[model samples]
Target: MSGKVVDDRDQLLGEAVGLRQAGKREEARERLVALSARFPQDAEIAYQTAWVHDTLGLEAEAVPYYERALAGSGLSDDDRRGALLGLGSTYRVLGRYEEAVATLGDAAARFPEDGALKTFLAMALYNTGRAHDAMEILLTLLAATSKAPEIAGYRPAIEEYAKDLDATV
Candidate 1:
């Protein structure tokens, strides 16, 4: 792409982000949808469009854009991660438990250290009737968190919650 086109795209993305940050989500989504149509092959645009839709609670509309973003090449790792997480959460919210589990599992494999991804994966597992697996993941996460000095204070509560979950399972 030409420098001018790149500059314009960047400017538009910035404006959309700014709008969303300013709590004008509907306007941001409208602008992003227009930009996405103009840059149909741009992974960043697709991701932004999907993000706006998802943030607006339009999960059904977000799904296609997230899929497009994931399918496109040249996305940064952060964008790819965001797309996967958004898609997985959207699937979960839509009650597509199997799809949520698969998507979140893939995300967890790719980003093992991302606690949020693991948490969501556990949720998907639990929703799919794999409560034992869900509790295991949560317990492991709690153990890891407890080892960190910054959040050690929460360890007791976490442990208690884990015990409660264990009892239920």
Candidate 2:
């Protein structure tokens, strides 16, 4: 692409993202739809399109965009992380629990300290009938990330329980 085309693409993408941030999601979605069609192979456009669709409750529509963004070589590390979480969470909401687990499991493995990924993964695990595993992840997340004074006092116990939720007192 020419520098002019690249500059235009960035400008348009920035406007679409601004719309999304300003709570003009419908407008953002419309702009992104056009942008995606215009720049089919653009990773940032694909990611933004998926994000807009996901925000608009269009999870099915978001999947291909997310997939394309991930497959693209140009996606930045941060956007790649967001795309992973977005796609996995979208799968969960769409009742594709197995896919959700697989996607999120991989994402959590990639970004081990991301609480949000683990939380969503736990939700998917519960959906797929792995309640014990789900609870373990949630409990561990709560123990490790909670800032409440109440939780602070119980962090040690919570950590222990997270390791073995089935253990008897």
- CA RMSD, predictions in order: 3.8, 1.1
Q: What is the lDDT of residue 40 in candidate 1?
A: 93
Task: List where candidate 2 sits over 4 angstroms from the true fold.
Answer: none
- Candidate 1, 65: how far from true, in Å? 0.8
Q: Record all residue pairs in model 2 with backbone atoms less than 3 Å apart, i.e. clashing.
A: none
True-vs-predicted CA distance for residue 19, candidate 2, Å: 1.5
What would the TM-scores of all predictions be?
0.87, 0.95
Root-mean-square deviation of Cα positions for candidate 2 versus the true structure, in angstroms = 1.1
Q: Pick the candidate with the highest lDDT.
A: 2
- Local distance difference test, each candidate: 0.90, 0.94
How many residue pairs clash in model 2?
A: 0
TM-score of 1: 0.87
Model 2 — which ten-residue stretch has the worst lDDT?
72-81
Off by over 4 Å in 1: 147-169
Q: Residue 90 in candidate 1 has what lDDT?
A: 93
